[model samples]
Target: MAIHRWRFVGIFILLAILGGAAMVMWNFIGLLLVSFAMAYIIYPLAGYFSGGNRKAGRKYLTACLSSVLLVALPVIYIMIYSLNVILQWLIENFGMIQSGSFTEGLKSGLDSAGFGVVSERLGSELGRLISSATDALWTQVTQPTWFLETSISLALFFVATFYFLYEGPRLMELIKKHIPTREKFLHELMSTIDKIFYGLFIGHLLTSVIIAGLAAVGFWAILRPPLITLGFLVGMMFVVSFLPLIGPWLMYVPMGLWYMALLPGGTMPGILILIYGSLMLTIVPDFYIRPKLVRRDADIHPLLILLGFFGGPFVMGFKGIIIGPLVLGLAQAIVMLYIEKRHILEDLFKRL
Candidate 1:
């Protein structure tokens, strides 16, 4: 068969177009990846809501509901609650500073330590710092460009998520149809990827829940923060726990320090809470249970999953949580395929 000369030209043009499109979309890569991941995670829920219906309206509605339930509501709740708690704490503390209570307390403590001379200067400096910080925060938050950009990004994210959920299966079928691969190998590869996704997301979620539960119980028993406040804080911790390195410690450590330094007769409870958090919240669940769960579901080594969890953020920021495990999991899958079909692969290579 004679090769068509224009076919090479067509291929070159297609490649150039794809490269240009990729460059244009590079800034939104994180947003798109997150949307895809969210859609993948919630697809089963979408399926359940659709009840095997193929109607476009039904699929769209189900995708919308699933995205909101699985992603939006929880994210909004965490952000709002965390911000409220932080703002409340700042307001109360600022009130104390304005009322001279905080400065008076600092002065008295400094006088006892022979540092009274510097207390006034320190208080004034702190007040100035807080004022400047508040001004800067207000300025940034009020920026029209920032607000517009954020709004647009959010809109795009939801749209992408909805379509991904609605069209994912069809897209997969289309891809499978075009890909030049044996059905069995492709199925195995896809199944492996699915298992890894399940292991990473579900395992992390369950670990967070378990840690949050432990934190709530510990707070109720030991620290004794207000019930509603404790719940809110624990919920925030649940979200933060998904991140590497910075977990419930963000809440517990500060609370521990506050207990030890601010409250009378709180040193013991503070120490106890710290110990409880370290052992129950951080060490056990994160290190042992999480990896075990991931290993069980993924059928990949716990060590690899752990590396992906911890090392991904270091390498690729937040998305690495998904990407790291996925990359490692894919590498594992490829190796396994090579091992299982070594003879065939070698024979093919020899023929080539």
Candidate 2:
């Protein structure tokens, strides 16, 4: 009994040590998880190009092209373009914003718009927030360690993402073979993931691009928002509009208010167009494009998409935006399938 007790304590000690080690290495683990998610999102296209193990050379080429064109370029473009727009906007408006009269003008405009109390509160909050952010930004810029760490993380992320995309299929096959689940259940799970991700990654990508272009053009043509800055903002909103407690309405409402402030006299037509344009961009994509594309590709219900998407971030944080819905959909599907296979409903009805 004494020897057995010693063995048990030793085992737990070893387990605790391993768990501590894992916790220390969690950032790298998280990066790998993110890489895997990205690779999974693009895997279907990679598989299509591979085409039944035609040639390794062909597979590599296709993966490279897909990663660059679909993932890399759009990301680079959004970041660089958005940064330039921000810098320019700041340079143009920095002095104006700092002026006392400009603050008074803004307050008067807010008063006119029936937001006097809220505006006062918001102004103080924004001032404090901005001051803190400026200090943080300066510290980060001056800190060599922060820059070095950031660079290393980015390097690791890209390298991991590349390899994951390039060799994801073989790894997946290995994983599936080793996964300790019945073949039928495993197949069902994979099927669910494929359907969910296909709709999520590819469908959302195309829809966001279309909506972004539409928003940029509409703002430029109708409301005449500073094309470069506001255009990018409107477009970026769609990409992240699915986030919980956030949406395009946040951006558009402020934008509409600003438009009114800029031209309080002749703003009625622009306001109408802004309203109409907002509806076109926000409503059409959520209702028509996303559902249509997702359903066409995955044959999943639109309600699942809504629940998984909007409800995901609340439960899962940013990544939960994808994983949350996927988990929910998978669980729901698996339960339904299990019940159907066992005649659970029929048995319950008979009992009733």
Best by lDDT: 1
The local lDDT score (0 to 100) that residue 235 gets in candidate 2 is 58
* lDDT (Cα, tens digit) per residue for candidate 2, span 122-211: 655555555465445556655869757765776676678778777666667777888655445556656666766665555664565666
Q: What TM-score should be assigned to candidate 1?
A: 0.63
Candidate 2, residue 331: the lDDT equals: 70
Clashes of each: 0, 0
lDDT of 1 by residue, 59-107 (tens): 6576556655677767667666755665666566766655667666665
Worst 10 residues of 2 by lDDT: 239-248
Off by over 4 Å in 2: 1-21, 44-58, 80-109, 112-114, 178-182, 199-210, 220-232, 243-262, 265-280, 283-288, 296-352
